[model samples]
Target: RRKAKRGQPPKPTPPPPVPPIEADEQVFAARLRGALYFFSSAKNRNAFLAHPARYANAPPPTSFLPPTAALLGPEAQALPLARTLSRKLGLVVLSLDEAVKWVLQGASPLAEILRPIVESGTPVSPLHQVQALQLRVSSPDTLRRGWLLLGAPVDGKIAEIMRVCSVLPSRIFGICAQHADASIAGLEAALKEKRLSHRLAKIDSSRNPLAQQHEVERVLLPLLRLRQQAVAATAEGEAHTAEGLEVTDDDFVAKLNPKFGFYCPVTWLNERRLHHCGDGEAAVAKRCAAEYKGVYVCCASDKQLSAMLLRPEEVLAGPPLPSPLPTKETQQAAAYGVSPSLWAELSGHCPVTLARGPKLGDYASRALALKEGKKEFCVEYESKRYVMASAECMEEFLATPWKFSRLTLPSKLLPASDPLDVGELPTRGYSEQTLGDSLKAALTDLLTLERPKYPTLSCTETALKFVALHLKANNPNVRAPHLKHKYSSKLHDYTERCGLLDAIMRTARSNGEVAAHSTASAATDATEERDQGRPGPEGSEPDQTTATAAHSESAACKKASEAPMPDLATLFKAWDEAVAAGLDIH
Candidate 1:
């Protein structure tokens, strides 16, 4: 090493060369597939070599875990399960017993209080146990990676204490045995009493260790992925801010049209984040024109969001909307309805038939009179002319026009405007037309399966009812059946060929009955199980049967996990497929 000058730093010295080790004392190494791995002992190396295929394709162990999680149950069950989770998820396991022992070894006030009880081998109270565990987990080193608490009693007092102390785990899992011990039963009772069963997932102790691990992983992986994505999004947002790419107030204002404000259903649906439309009407119109389709406008006005599905080529050829967007109240008034003002505005010079006659009072008689073309009488009210069957009926209607003229608006004139509630707005990126077409296709397929002999009015009406029900299920705005009348017209000549409509109706009724019966039976079973003081299946609340209650939930979770995180295009595609397959849009 060279000596340095007084004001300068000393020169670094070279490390000494090491002697080569004997081959027998060298580290064990092997190549599996295309990757190299080193093992501390020959036993592990040999194990890997024995099943290279199993080890080769396995996911590399990850240290990622949920922010906080807890495991509760008997020592015999919880300890092993905690260890398994620790290995699987790279979590820090902090056992209550170990925490207690650590606390007793210290001079903390909680330790002083617990010392006598612990020494006597008496069970520590939930409060004291929580305090000890809190003391251990509060250490920065214990929570560097996320932690898994072990062997904590599932008591509300402990949970409440932990919450007050700001140390509550984000997730809790309880080990449940078919034949529970006294302590286990007590824990379950506390869970039930506190209504904390929903917060705790029961892990069946009878299943194999691998199955247990898989269940925990299944519950945890999605949450971990979601958390990771959220963190990544936050990081990206910060990065954008640092890079001066974040949207400023001025920038946001600049994106708006000043006259016709921007609205992008894509961002609103997929991310639940609002952004000004990047593409102007001209650009949108051009794109729609190129595709030979009209632009579907999603309008956002005060307290309401509405979507209008324009017919093809309407965007290019139709007149522009009026300046200054209309209020929801005005728009509702403008719609042709029972409002007399609306009738006066739209009646113009056209004449309409008084479908209901003041004297006839019956639908059959009115239809017969209309068929016979008895138009000798007429009355004018609210600038609208109504043709009547007889002079007496016209005079009677004129005497009290309001009473006899309470007519529903024709379906065609009732604007197919779907008003979406802010809370229940569509989060899936699907156009109204796409959804309707998919539904129509599915119904057509089902009708084909029925093999109808000839289309009948009854069949068309039944199909219309089905479509209305399906639409109402998806969108609360679709209250009336008139909006789907056009779809029924298209199918009117292709349904109810040979009593197929009756068969379809019967099947729908049967399905509804079966579903109702199953739900009632499950509820009864759950009530019986609770009354008997028996725990239900794993991952279910005391009032729920997992086999039934969890079926729909697990299916939804599976779809969410398997599907890619939705963007506009992907969500639209997924929604189209779901609708076409006749799956309920949960």
Candidate 2:
């Protein structure tokens, strides 16, 4: 135990080995992808933001989804795609509650949590946050290829398709009256008779029997190539595991047919295409070659193309997707050239745009000032002043910008020696006092009074000076010129020195203080003084203390020789007679 030898002394056995932690890259990556994909779709993004924790443990089901499907559940179907796509986009896929918690802990940008994973290094992939998604499904093969070949699960394809559906118009059917060799009058007559020419408008407006078919083809070409690539990849992935095992499942070629539904990039719907082969192998490819098994594109009498998709087994095993019987409503939509799927997509995503605005007011003001060479007459409203060319036009106008337009507010006038004449009646209304005329009236009153001293006008010092000037001008005989000259400076000095007004004000303040102290002192002296003046509680005569004080005061007064006392009885009789005559004591 005491082996303390050199360096090799006590190389104690390392503490029990700790198990290595598992890397969560794949799981985290998948979650991130899901978050980005959800945010990319307007519908899903809105739903999440509205109820952050709604998707924490679970979310609500969207349109056409079964009740059994819990929309908010973390394990819900949308998550699979969300995880994968989030990885592609480089976004973080944590629940809204988690995101909020991080933000509360001083996390910045808020989007940082979702951004890194969504933008993970993919060039073509969309960012974590997107304004909208436009879904354009051209073929079934595209969907099949995206799912089977790119290792994308059905959920992932569904998520992408949902996002793409968000930006399309709401109504699938568009209508236009058909005019084949008909005059405008004839068309008007037809309309009056409840008849109109119509045809179904495809969701992809670029594609039809004619016009822009090449553009449609151009966009569709890539999907076709991808389909081929997907097929090859699936076959390779399958063969590596198949070894020499013979596959007996050959229902593929028998199930071949073209069918369409809501398709987005990298996703398609095909019954016999493939399913997970299990045992870690790609699903076997099956052809959709069955006769009369294609999806029915129903065109109503009005030209509406409404789809009634047949069951997967029906399309794959024996029959084609049934053509939907067109009702009056469907017919009307088709007549207008609107596709149901397109309409659905459009309604799913609503887009809005607005025009740009003009420059800021300050910038405009500076520009206006620069345009005029000299400083123009101006007045400030709400701390913002702008110059105008003329004062006569606006000098007396009210500048209420909130109620009136800036153009309506007039410019102010600068003082001049000669009496300034306004050019015309102002477009805006104003108060005479606003024209700096209040001081003139006050001064006029001060000078007309017969009193020797000036009356103090309760107003700003600026107004006082103007008032003083009027007094000096009107009362020339009095030596009040010096007083007028000193008025402004005296007012200023008085406000600064005593920090108060004149004698009247000081007297009023002193009286208020004296009254308050007297009230308090009277309250305190009440018990002692009440006994000396009034009778006791039981109606006894006045106390000895009061009698003694009265005697002392009477003696002192006698020694000084004061007025004679009057008889109480005589005084009472006179008072009674006065009362009888209706004389008031007050």
- Highest lDDT model number: 1
Clashing pairs in 1: 452-497, 453-497, 453-498, 454-497
Best-matching candidate per TM-score: 1
lDDT string for model 2 (357-380, tens) is: 123444444233321101233333
Candidate 2, superposed: residue stretches over 4 Å from native: 1-433, 451-586
Candidate 1 C-alpha lDDT tens digits along 26-49: 466776444577666778777777
TM-score of each: 0.30, 0.14
Cα error, residue 504 of model 2, in Å, equals 16
What is candidate 1's local distance difference test score? 0.51
CA-RMSD of model 1: 38.0
